[model samples]
Target: MTAPQTAEQPVYDPSDPSVMANPFPIYAKLREDDPVHWSPSLKSWIITRYTDVRDLLLSDHLSVNRLATFYQSLPPADAVLLKDIVHYLNLWLAFRDPPDHTRVRRILRHAFTASAIEHMRPNITEITDLLLDRLESGGRNEVDLIREFALQLPAFVIMDLLDVPRDMLDDFKEWSDDMAVFIGGARNSGDKYERAERGCRKMSSYFAQLIKERTENPKPGFLMDLISARDEGDKLSEDELIATCILVLFAGHETTTNLIGNATLLLLRHPDQLAKLKSDPALIDSAIEEVLRFDGPTNALVRVAAEDHDLHGRQIREGERVFVMVNSANRDPRIFKDPDRFDITRQQNRHLTFGQGIHLCLGAKLAREEGRIAVERLFARFQNLALDPSEPPEWLDAMVPRGTRHLPVLLNG
Candidate 1:
């Protein structure tokens, strides 16, 4: 049963610009008043409390296969137009339930092993330095960190990992941006489906060709590994291979880009903490964790109920959509002391930015390494780094992914 609305209760609307800007206040309100409230605006049950969101993510009753539910909810015409989008999304490991999820995850685990990520550390640093070198050579004191450094570092690192040519960077960004609108659940983007479909077509076609070429002449890289990865004599089908490549290409850089950007902005906003990090460079890891808890790239994760479940006197029926509000839970007063404060040295931090349980982000280690190295080198390179006074940071008007659209900063501050 849905909770009754009260005048004091703030409505949960992601489309609202204010909400998009800073949803924590409304998230706090929802967490206090109705933790498991059904929102008519989004037509999905919004789970706010830390425990509720955590348990649901770790629960078997909730499935990550929500794309089909979304397709069904759309008008027939729109659904038909997004058929290819659904097809590719369905093949993604993120959208599958075990034993499909279990098998693919096993294969991927071998590829993203700690040693593999650690081996890339040097390359990550090289890419970071290369980007900073370019920035320094540009002779521009003012730069959009999001565009110039943060976004490029991860994209290049992932490209190098996959052995993708450097020339495809711009195309990948364009395609990734288009798909983000749909995948990230941009509430206000009316043409999201069309844009995403176009991205999907181009991306899938490109990967299909790449996979064929790689299969013909084997290479020693991540893409080649995906091409030949197997689990207990089982391997990914052709379609699955293409889908996994796209997932790796997209998810590989998007969140980490946001992490770098968000971490930079947060540190700039809290100079005390920024100075603390500068003094103790080892605090980079803890600082990254703090940034995720404070304002992580992923705001929420969508899941669909596989069976009826009751929580806090609210019934979530089967097939109904549920959004586990990660940003809200990270700030739950019950969970963290002074949750709002940006503290790098904080201990026992367990933010759900990478999610939990079976669906925990596969590239977590890679992202952490990328963010730590990127931020560490960035600050090390520009000791006087500061936000540009003329242009302020702008947050992406997105619901699922929390990131700044532009983080203008004075490089030589």
Candidate 2:
């Protein structure tokens, strides 16, 4: 009888294409051999297992307040600039812990109800339709879907949601892009960090101005809602309101943009699944779910251990950062049978794409709806949607919400 051979362990490198393009093999090995291994490269513990990841996310012992510690670790001069950046991040709902997270979430939920998202479907559909039409008007047989369609759809939707003036659309996108690059920890050179700080300062000032104007004129939007919303007779502070706006504006569209682009490219690569989707357009929802599980927009989230603890036979100390590999947990063989293969019709597909626990994405439902509409409308409009032979897909170096930089596709009738 031949003995079973073990898979070689891979060094952790979040930006490596080998890891980004296909992290399952590495994740599988880690899950089996070292589920709670610490990575010196990341300076954090990497948790990669369906059960462990889910449990840690739900555990109150860990915290999302690790950013402050990170900022403090920077050089003195950089810390000054990072202080201004972290100021806004500190107020973000995603970066808060305990009582603050509980309070802000309660207030924020009032604005993002399912009914509100459903009501916006008509507007979302209108935006998607218009963007698709714009794609064709350029008089080109090939188009970069990432730039021409996927990117604009979510930005416009967010603009509409926030009642942002149409004139400010370009500025908003620039700011959001900067935020994503900075937050995703991609291309983190000194110049890049400076650019992120400039973006943070500009957005902070812009939102502050908007809040001041809205205070007197009043408006119908998420910003306005946050302005007026009260929790136990406590309304959001001016700084809090500005921070929340920045958080939602960036989080709202960035993930969806990646989701649409990633899902479309996935479908283009897997013709069998694409044929299935085209054959039964109703499967768009399930197909979107599958793409999310297969190659989710987000790869991991960092949480800090609150105290010393033992997990899966490994000891973790207080204040140490833990990187929960959501992308890995979704593909755990224990949970999903034949997890490597893409099957849109897979039943009971419980993936951690939107994450779980109290911090689950508030925009999950809306993002899913947008992905569904984008896929359905694109396939319906173009009979032939294949990757452009001239330009291959360029995956972004981002680790958090990984996706293509541009996806040029041959769009033929």
Candidate 3:
């Protein structure tokens, strides 16, 4: 991990929606202008250099538990959301760092293996087909790519993985949407809290019943497997299990939903690449990698300094917050061939979309499957697909991730 120096002033202010709206340019400027800077808003230094972000990610001196730092960075009101919701429950692995992260992660690790996801391939294929059936049934109408394909696939796949019945699919989606409010676009303060609170209560109750039932009469499923697995003698606590389930279901749905939507929009934006993919099909994997490289769903992650140390020369005080911009690193010219353009055939492509180190996204395999299959099916179904060129995409730039809220596309059979 290459360390970098910085001044007391912030490199950039990400809280501004305008900056968040199109941060690539700003990120590019930051990497060139001031790779390391302190933000008055965040009160934390920003690290934008591709090498620096990579170094900090793998460095033992930094911990992913940036809860305290994140709270301070937020406006007083926004602090409530971070402290109350994102921090309190400690549901997911992304929030944890080091030994515990390794411990808790080991239990659920087996379930996310390639073979485990392989068992789900047939089901994912079926769900993808069923969704497209609904869209095509409508025929020639203005289709919202986000709702129809992006949101629908992940919701069902995650529900099915957790052995959520075929019946409560709608309920699952509603719960996911509510939970996503804090992170996704158009988050209403009242509505976000209301929805998240309601979701937390409902999901906790529902999973409690499931956990109890599995305890009494265990089945052969993800929920059952997770419950059964124990390290030495210690097992994941009830809250941990519930929180873990919530993380898997919610995180699984959230990022992949945006991946499909963003990929679709970007592909049409580059018609030649789409045509190349449509013609060759072999390029889809590389294309998928590039889509994430170009504009992955997740913007950045929060980390805290675990020790007072020097990064590239500047002193990083212990407990200070750091926002590691993964998206910015993906576009760094030092790592990538052409940092900006969307080139499907670009060979030496390795983007940090799933993040890095011990905290790399767990469900990346499943997400990639959904993205690959969704694009394949979509291009196959619609011969000539293009943006409703006139109508602009409704962009959703929220606190959590980035993607269009609604992308209306004209699909021709």
Candidate 4:
């Protein structure tokens, strides 16, 4: 079967409400009928199959640094307006390739090692308990889990990791939310460019100050580590340092927030799985992995073709954008047996939630630890946790990140 070239065929639009709510069915159709699809509207080839997505992620034929091309393609006036945003975004480690990426990854690896993440287990537990304390004391059974719990937990965790004060979380969230609108490809957001530019400027300025303070009076955490991180005398430039801090603050919490939110909601919907997990808390690790594979936070990963090449019969021209649908790939039956089933005990899971290869998520371990701690604590605290029947959970309408906008649930303790 193949996607027919007919006017009646529905085009893949990430911003579409129905698709954002539950894209799996559409993903299944595209995977079976058109594994490599070209979206006329998006002007990007969407890769859905697991093998193709993984290979592309690990392939040297693609480039993660597409901001320059984007800026060049923009109108002069628009480009001028977005120069600051592009400058900082260009400096992000995630957007760099080759030697630069290699150097930075080496220096940064020390901070995110398995032992380092495990050491923070106690701190993670403390943060989780603190947040749960607040949630339980709210004097109401109904609450928006995304805002009250899921969002705040990772924000606090990252904030603590950076030695940022708790009072600054609201400001950080505001700036991160604005930037997410632009970076997440929120199609309907008006003035997204301006908002993102403002956010970029404010966040950059804040990080610059923090970096200056940390330089003069170094703290004992990840931020301090990044400040002194040097690989063969190759240290991060001032701009690179600031950009990395912003990246950590933004990317660190946002995806984990989605992970916790998605996992909790999924469990609530699947009482049998929830019961199983509750009965055997040892499955928390496997359950977290399953959540990552089942309905992970990341929706798509974008890359640009480094050179013209044919992929699965489709000619990918240089500079063209490619949307590697990780969500689609995770559900690919070829890689996962009965991929649609929400089985927490599945052992052969090899989902690309954190991506693959050298560009794999730097904070994957932290995110996993955070998710495990958060979900375990939440379920343990509220035995009768469930979705509020009156209000259905709303998913975020963005192309890059998948998460709940609001998860109203009954914490029937």
Task: Tell me the alpha-carbon RMSD of every candidate.
Answer: 1.2, 3.7, 3.8, 2.0
Per-residue lDDT of 3-53 in model 3, one digit per residue for the tens? 343563334766566676677888888777777766665567777788888
Candidate 2 wrong stretches, greater than 4 Å? 1-8
Model 4, residue pairs in steric clash: none
- Using TM-score as the measure, the top candidate is 1
Q: How well is each residue in 27-92 modelled by candidate 4, as lDDT tens digits? A: 998888777888876888899999999999999889999888998999988898899889988887
- Model 2 lDDT per residue over 1-413, tens place: 11122355445676677676667788888888878877766777888999899999999768999887788788999888777778989998889987998888988887888888898899889999998888767779888898888988888888777767766878988877777777876743446677778888888899899889989999786667778887678778889888988887788788898899989888888989989988888888889999899988888887899888889767788889888999999999999999999998888889998888888998999999999998889988887878998888887776677688888998882
Q: Estimate each model's TM-score.
A: 0.97, 0.95, 0.88, 0.97
Q: Compute the lDDT of residue 25 as modeled in candidate 2.
A: 86
User: How far is 374's C-alpha from truth in model 3 (Å)?
Assistant: 0.7
Q: Residue-pair clashes per candidate, as listed?
A: 0, 0, 7, 0
* TM-score computed on alpha carbons, candidate 1: 0.97
Q: What is candidate 1's CA lDDT for residue 163?
A: 75
Worst-scoring 10-residue span by lDDT in model 1: 1-10
What are the Cα lDDT values of the candidates? 0.89, 0.83, 0.78, 0.89
Alpha-carbon deviation at 365 in model 4, angstroms:
0.3
Question: Candidate 3: where is the Cα deviation over 4 Å?
Answer: 1-18, 68-88, 166-170, 181-195, 312-314
Stretches of candidate 1 above 4 Å error?
none
